[model samples]
Target chain A: MTPRPQQEPTCHGEDYAPFERALLNDYQHELPLVPRPFAAIGEQLGVSEQAVLEALQRFREQGVLSRVGATLKPGAVGAATLAAMGIPERDLEQVAAIVSARPEVNHNYEREHELNLWFVAMAADDAALRAALTAIENETGYPLLDLRLVCDYHLDLGFDIQWTSANETDA
Target chain B: MDVSERDRRLIGALQAGLPLVRRPYAVIGEAVDMSESEVLRRIAALRDAGVIRRFGVIVRHHELGYRANAMMVWAVPEHQVDSLGERVAESPQVTLCYRRRPAPPQWPYNLYCMVHGRDRETVLAVRDELVARHGLEGMEHRVLFSGRRFKQRGARYLAPKQEAIGREANHGRA
Candidate 1:
């Protein structure tokens, strides 16, 4: 694993307007799935598909847009599992290497606390997801706090939810 | 930059359904009253705009017996967060890894990650190992698993034809 940079550019301050946030949050739904989807989106917004393209491109660069692809449900076609672990501040960098090295895990992030490292594993089946998780724990020695979703509601964590219009009369 | 009505219509069709045919573009064209080649060009344009990320299948997890799933949040030391963030992302079980800015005193954790699993036991087992290996015994964390799935849909964004919403006005309640 590479060494952690002394610091990362915080995704704060005036990163975007409420419009971009709303757009990022709901951009996927706006995407036209037709042959010429881009033009279709343009038609809806009264903007050229080119504008939508440019805006989305800018969003991607800003980290507000994770990806525009289909966010298919997990464990559907193949398999997936939720896993987490507490990483001591000192050893986090080293442990992250072990966790991220697995081919099954897709997304990972950092949070505050002892169980610092969190990630997910997708596989062809439940067994594979488990085996992979077990292997990760065994190798890393960090316990995984795996929480399986019995039910999901509005699981779409749209980053656009952050959008708050300045025009809101209350504000 | 501005988008047009035709583009919205096109996205609506695809979000509704990616025509399952040899020439899906041609089928979409027929529905919206456009030529297949024209549909294809428009789609390319949307791809450039980042509106349509990918043309892929929408899958269901429970149907395949992945009955359980959860969002696992972890607190890694600020220094080690990034490296660890990348490592956990490599796991297939882990999806949607990110480092959200946590709120004040109560949540000092600078790191947050997620994982999906078939059941609780499986998730716990995986969690334990991560704790031990990452040497995360000293931090605080939480696991907010999804209790129910209320609404999940393909892109519901359709720039209204009549109302012109400024960039800031666009939003959906989660």
Candidate 2:
């Protein structure tokens, strides 16, 4: 299929206001190590265990919630990274299929610009991840511009759309 | 927020905690006074809506011994972003890929994507393939690897009217 220029906002729900940002917030604490943690939270929210369960179902039913499982730090357990590519218009689909077929690749996105492709890599470690990149380079005949993360001034995004760092003088 | 009362109770519990026992549903039933089957059905509904993305283990990459990681950003041609994105994300190495309004002047590329691997070498190999396969010869990309992890966890689900509950999403893993 012929690819066309398109912009997809991942932070969708722009058409309609988010039902409540709070529901998506508050993961700072450890998940209840015990069984029936939901029951515990239900007591605090002044609702029934059933209510908590169903509400999550509904948020997911709507496009508000993304996942209800644990968010483990991939870096600690394994290795991962982010990268992008510059593909021609005609061969994007073929490339996408090939890329997704790999186990290491995960997040993928399309943008509007010269280097219009971007994605994240979560491999078991640095060597493995680099090896994967090399294999890709060999197949595609293009050197990947590896821009490793230097510092993350802001890591936790999305939840606090209105959050501002202490050094808000510049923006 | 607009869920039925029954749903409210179920969600409330889920938001608080999920049973980690063999019969998690049974424990949940005791709290909400519903059958395990009922709880499972409700979860299925949420997943269908793209709200509850899934019920799986949140992997701790570093703990799993994966040290090298970066946020690889790409700059594909505007016409090929979608197809390219699908391909880039196709690799299980990638965890996220969508679209972002690139920062002007500072950030030239608009199309953003990701790929995760064991180390820098593995990731670079896959990236190189895309570069050549897609014919991206002259493009800028940054593979920003993480040195410190401030926080990371499942996305919080807050309604529009409520105050977002901010928690320290990621704990120490060093």
Candidate 3:
């Protein structure tokens, strides 16, 4: 993999209001499954239903929230694999575009490693997954490292962000 | 479990996102031409059937002050991976953990775990503790911090016809 500059954390500073932060940190993992979920959130948070809806809308618009929906378990509905490819620097963008062009490819990232171009592909079944991987390998001309997940543990991406340095540890 | 055409449409609409409104189901039903009750019923059925995992807020970790994130891979003995993976995942600091196929000759790490924290140092500390606790001191491993995220989105599991249309669009662009 072509050596790229190490990435610094881009997300910093607490610019959001207290309610927004509370909504983000607390209500992220579980949104009540109700006819008026936002209303429930509002009732608990001491905010109006309209205020909760507006805050969520703003959060989604600002990229603070990806969505208000279900995170389908990998391999639950179909076959999926975490794949990586080692592409030459010159062909990185070309290869990445080719890989990302597939609709099944949900996540594509550039990591710091020899097998740089990493992505996750999901399809209707095993046959479709194999076909997609084979097509990507054939197009990119790079041997794909297909890593099927054996098991997922603690895969929750959402966590309570401690604004204070409560659990801060030295490097 | 087969999903009806209307249910497929609901899934497609939901994959995009549920609206932040008082009557979200009603709003979504209006868009998908389904009744509010029908949409609610279908969603419940989908959740029960395991098609939809859990309806919740998809938080952006980075945006929410999780600055440092590393995908750490370790080459553990094949037999020990399952047990070690469970132990490592029990830590709150380790957000994701799994056993993946190792790329031989170059990459020989089958066990992978993601550690996310407010800073690089915090993440590193967590990693060190995990390594020491798991007795993975002598193991060959590497921490690959995410440099740039090109794309991140929900997995699209629409109807086969919608999948075909998506492929066609991508092919046209290519």
Q: lDDT winner among the candidates?
A: 3
Q: B142 in model 1: Cα distance from truth in Å?
A: 5.8
Across B120-140, the per-residue lDDT of candidate 3 in tens digits comes to 898889889998888999999
TM per prediction = 0.46, 0.44, 0.83
Residue A163 error, candidate 2, Å:
39
TM accuracy, model 3: 0.83
Candidate 1 chain B worst ten-residue window by lDDT:
B165-174
Across residues B78-144, which tens digit of lDDT does each residue of candidate 2 receive?
6766676666655544555554434444465555545555578976887788777766668777665
Q: Provide the overall lDDT of each model, using Cα atoms, as 2-decimal numbers.
A: 0.52, 0.48, 0.75
Candidate 3 residue spans exceeding 4 A from truth: A1-14, A155-157, A164-171, B1-10, B30-34, B41-51, B163-174
Selected candidate, larger lDDT, 1 vs 2: 1
**Fraction of true A-B contacts recovered by candidate 2:** 0.04
Query: Which digits, one per residue and each the tens of the lDDT, describe model 2 over residues A1-171?
Result: 223233321222232223222233443223333346556656656666665556555444443444445333223224555565667757655555555555455555454445545555555457877887777767665445554542221222222222122115436
Worst lDDT 10-window in candidate 3 chain B: B165-174
Worst 10 residues of 3 chain A by lDDT: A1-10
Q: Count the backbone clashes (under 3 Å) in each candidate.
A: 120, 170, 0
Model 3, residue B113: distance off in Å is: 1.0
Give the DockQ-based CAPRI class for model 2.
incorrect
Ranked by TM-score, the better of candidates 1 and 3 is: 3
